[model samples]
Target: MRDDEDLPFVAALYASVRAEELAATGLPEAQQRAFLDQQHRAQHAHYRAHYPTAEWLILEIGGTPIGRLYLDEWKREFRVVDISLVAASRGQGIGGAVLADIIAAAKAAGKGVSIHVEKHNPARRLYERLGFVLAEDKGVYDLMEWDMARPSDQGASEP
Candidate 1:
């Protein structure tokens, strides 16, 4: 996200993403709100501290912010720190298109792309459709990776 100006929206987006899980906790409404805000702050701070070089971007359509996409490009791979859209925007093709673009760019650069996704996140299906294979099983989360063969690596006719 750009600055303090974007925090409120981002925090709300974060809360929305966690709403389902939070509801399962059966916490009081006010406690849930406070917990969500605290969790959002902690997650934001953690991302900033750990992914210093990542690009923090707000996804917008017609100048209205709808989501966030944070990416960290390393020497041999691009790490998707996080990508999320508002409830109204989920299941739309916006996310698929965004992932396709990122995959294409990774293909062009001969670098792999990776992201950690919750074990049961519905988005796992989308990632699988995009050719991301499970790379690591981290208990609650799985690391998914996508790689494209470079031009030089695609041919084996010459012995």
Candidate 2:
């Protein structure tokens, strides 16, 4: 989980995720970087204020920072607030491993695991493959959920 010292890395991770999208704006490099930095700080503050008790985790590989995972375990469900990886870290199965762990923990506690995924996000496929089904559609995003109590062959084992 993150502590005060991890904020810089967390902000960098956030900026990395938006690099491509911000680039598309045709803004100057300096401006784009500044905008991303400001946005990242605001987002960090928003998450802290809203999900005060959420676990803020930094995903590292060989001591190198690669991604971030934020989770909130409520009385009835385990909510995945956010999970993001740098471009170099994507498609490496790290996310699946982390999510599998979360699933196992949720199962042990008899709680469902849920995440809100953006409408066209690639991660949606990963969620579906891991047994998360659409619970609701919030226009821009869809609420996906996996209940441990449900009977299925997709039980948490691997992947």
In terms of lDDT, model 1 sits at: 0.85
Cα lDDT tens digits for candidate 2, 1-159 = 545698888878888888988899999999999999999888888888989999888888899989989999999899999999988888878788788888888988989999999888888777887889999999989999988756235533333
* Predicted model with the maximum lDDT: 1
Checking candidate 1 for backbone clashes, the offending pairs are none
* Backbone clash count, each prediction separately: 0, 0
Name the top TM-score candidate.
Answer: 1
Cα lDDT tens digits for candidate 1, 1-159? 546688888999999999999999999999999999999999999999999999988999999998999999999999999999998888877887788778778888889999999998988878877778889999999999987642222211111
TM-score of each: 0.91, 0.88
For candidate 2, what is the TM-score? Answer: 0.88
Residue 129 lDDT, candidate 2, scale 0-100: 74
